[model samples]
Target: MEKVNYKGADLLAHRFEIRVIRHFNNAIEYNAVPFILTEIQKRSDDFFQFPLSNGLLGTTIVDSAVTVTINKNIAYEPRRYFTCAHELCHVLLDTEYIRSHPGIDTEDKNGLPSSKNSSRERRANHFAALVLLPDTILNALMMEKKSKSYIRHQQKVSYETLKYRISDFIQLRFLLSRSMALDIASAFADKDADPLQQKGIYGFWHAAEDENISPLSRQQIAQKNNDLALGLIDPMVFEGCK
Candidate 1:
């Protein structure tokens, strides 16, 4: 699998955060559906939703007018919200790729593309996480000693997403290894048994692994994540590559 353009994803998510606040009268909470619909309207695009089966989460179609279709069968409101944001990321960020590819960009049950090699899918997932739970908001919550349940309930994101976001923050902010970060995040998220071992959380964290994949070292991962967090890297470096 190709490397995900984390800097580019961060920049796009930050811009969307600004737009959400501006468009919604300084609203910080991103109501994914309404914001997505408003963005589609601004771009003169079309949107649809249907109760799809077979593990389909959403699809982005790029044609005369870009259309986003989401699965209404996602019974969990948080999962539905995440699916909407994930599809919207494709519409807004992957326009050129979608146009060139000329087919459906479908998300699986996990709200990610079934193809593991797709860096676009990974980037979109990261973008969805960042846009929904921005760094500043998460930082403030952490500073206030807010419990993971409180934060998760207030943000309306899944435990899996919350764990990943918290781990990402811990890794970047504290320059810690992935394992260390996950350990800390697990403590914050669930004081009982290890929640990281749970089905979705485990798979989501390691789904990109392959025998041929050379995992980045802790130092490298920390530097990259911190560079993006601290605005030390230019997002344009990833402009045409991703």
Candidate 2:
């Protein structure tokens, strides 16, 4: 099968994330991380997780309802959140892709971005990264800190694996020089962004702290989900989704 345009898949993921933010909650000060689970639950009722003694991080099933199964034994805290987000990518963005290729489980050995990734796997990874760090919040932080180093210090992020990921995000968001992104990567010691920060920074839809999670006022979550779903049905563009 031809590889899907990764840029398109990533953009589609971003669109979905924006809907998640707009639909669930839009307050600036409130945390938006819990919405990951909230959005998952909103999409499907039965969500499940278990410890994979094996090295595998997570998996998702799309039978009557989507169910996310995660590795409970992982050492890193951020890894679990990353795994869940990755599986959600498969659920939200790759539903048709999985349907066409049944039983081909989406597995990851640590969920690191790899040069050897298959097309769908690459898309899912990118989707997870973006959902974990929405550009709007990132932009606000970056603009406020004035230096990526300052943001790193304030957030206490120090993941070696994430240096490259942050570089990718900088490249995607600011369209800055690769050298600048590389410069930003060196400030951190050896850690990823805080998943706790993600929870406090992001939020549950309609969580008490969020002033913006009102239901059915004007923003349309269902409509946006329906629209994004059509684009994802056939992610490989030349095969004719357009």
Candidate 3:
């Protein structure tokens, strides 16, 4: 099965990126999501080590100047950074293609760039995987885990016998809660549903935080999301979702 683009919504996946970059704090750090995003954009040429452009997947034509907006509502900070990177892909790679292949996800043909169901969407997704988990950085991260796993084993990020402790430096600088900061963890662990389906659950969970819900009750949301997806979700593209 294919992963939902989330229109670049899930921020949790970028936890590793945030955690790693924080180690070099004087190099990059931010109190808010937007600042971090802009800093990231500035450092993209250095970190992602990729050339930038406003290309799309033929059908969808998004925009050239991609704006990375930090969602302050989510409880997780890394999730915010992940979202910025995901949108960065669309801005950097999906603008033109979206215009040409516009089809699904179009509320109207008015002015918005259209997309061909999930083609343009899926391609940007592939782009995100390449963006977030580029081979070099991933290897370095894996090594921190003391991972003895070979290339073939690299795919098993979650189950690997190694464990790389989240650096204390990152937690202090980023102001990340330990539970919120660990692992390039996925915000939603739902197995029954795709990322798109689980986004609402994430959004709602964040919303509930501002409400009067008890801490114990909040714990149920994650478990519930997993339960909802357990029978329905199917893994795709990557393993351990990292």
Leading candidate by lDDT? 1
Per-model TM against the reference: 0.70, 0.59, 0.32
Write candidate 1's Cα lDDT for 101-180 as tens digits: 76537788866577644788877788888877887767655544455666666666777787789889767655757876
Compare candidates 1 and 3 on lDDT and give the better one.
1
lDDT (Cα, tens digit) per residue for candidate 3, span 56-85: 211222344323333334333333343444
Top-down lDDT ranking: 1, 2, 3
Which consecutive 10 residues in model 3 have the weakest lDDT in total? 158-167
Over 4 Å off in model 3, which ranges?
Answer: 1-36, 39-72, 100-116, 146-242
Instruction: Estimate the overall C-alpha local distance difference test score of candidate 1.
Output: 0.64
RMSD of each: 12.4, 15.5, 17.7
Query: After TM-score superposition, what is the CA distance of residue 62 in candidate 2 from its true location, in Å?
Result: 3.2
Model 3, total clashes: 27
CA displacement after TM-score superposition, residue 215 of candidate 2 (Å): 42
Best by TM-score: 1
